[model samples]
Target: MQKKLVLGTAVAAVLAAGTFGAVSANASAPAAAPAAVVKADAGSDNLFRTNHLTIDAATDAAEAVLDAAEKENQRVSVAVVDRNGNTLVTLRGDGAGPQSYESAVKKAFTAVSWNAP
Candidate 1:
């Protein structure tokens, strides 16, 4: 029993020492360097400029749709999206259906994606 206890204690000490050494070695190691940021050149062929509608222009377009719907005695929602299919303006006219908001946005996105009216 005594021999067994002594052998077990020695094994435990060895494992503990190995764990501590590994931890200390890792702690002393240098940290990884940060990644460098590369800026794209203004005239780079990989990057192209895209024109999108301004907020004022998008809002005006949405308002025009709403006005036309109102003149036709129709309650509706209007949405204006940019060339990237990003919704810029959404107008829910009076008494418009609850689902009209999402529908209008989808319609605008579809139009922008297809580049159609």
Candidate 2:
């Protein structure tokens, strides 16, 4: 029993020593610096960061479309998309057809694809 106790204590002490050495080695190493940020110029190939419309502008465009529909005495849905063809605003006028929502989004996406106003 005494021999077994001594053997267990010796194994534990060796493992503890190894863990302490590894921790100290890692602690002494220098940390890596953060990556630097680079800004893209107007003619740069970073297209994703360019030609983005703010939420307010997108919403205004959508409202303008809705107002036009109102003047024509028609209920409709209007969608405004960013340069990336992602819908930023979708407005469904009162009594508009259920499918009008999808139609408006598709129209917005088509305009973006064709680079039209």
Candidate 1 TM-score, C-alpha based? 0.56
lDDT of each: 0.46, 0.46
Please report the TM-score between candidate 2 and the true structure.
0.55
Q: Candidate 1, which ten residues in sequence have the lowest lDDT sum? A: 20-29
RMSD (Cα, Å) for all candidates, in order, is 30.9, 30.3
- Candidate 2 lDDT tens digits, 1-117: 323322222222111111101111101101121112334786878643323344554554455555555665666766656556777677787878787777766765765577552
Work out how many backbone clashes candidate 1 has: 0
90 in model 1: Cα distance from truth in Å? 0.5
Which stretches in model 1 have alpha-carbon errors above 4 Å?
1-50
lDDT by residue for model 1 (1-117), tens: 323322222222111111101111101101121112344677887864433344554454455555555666666666655446666667777888787777766655665566452
Worst 10 residues of 2 by lDDT: 20-29
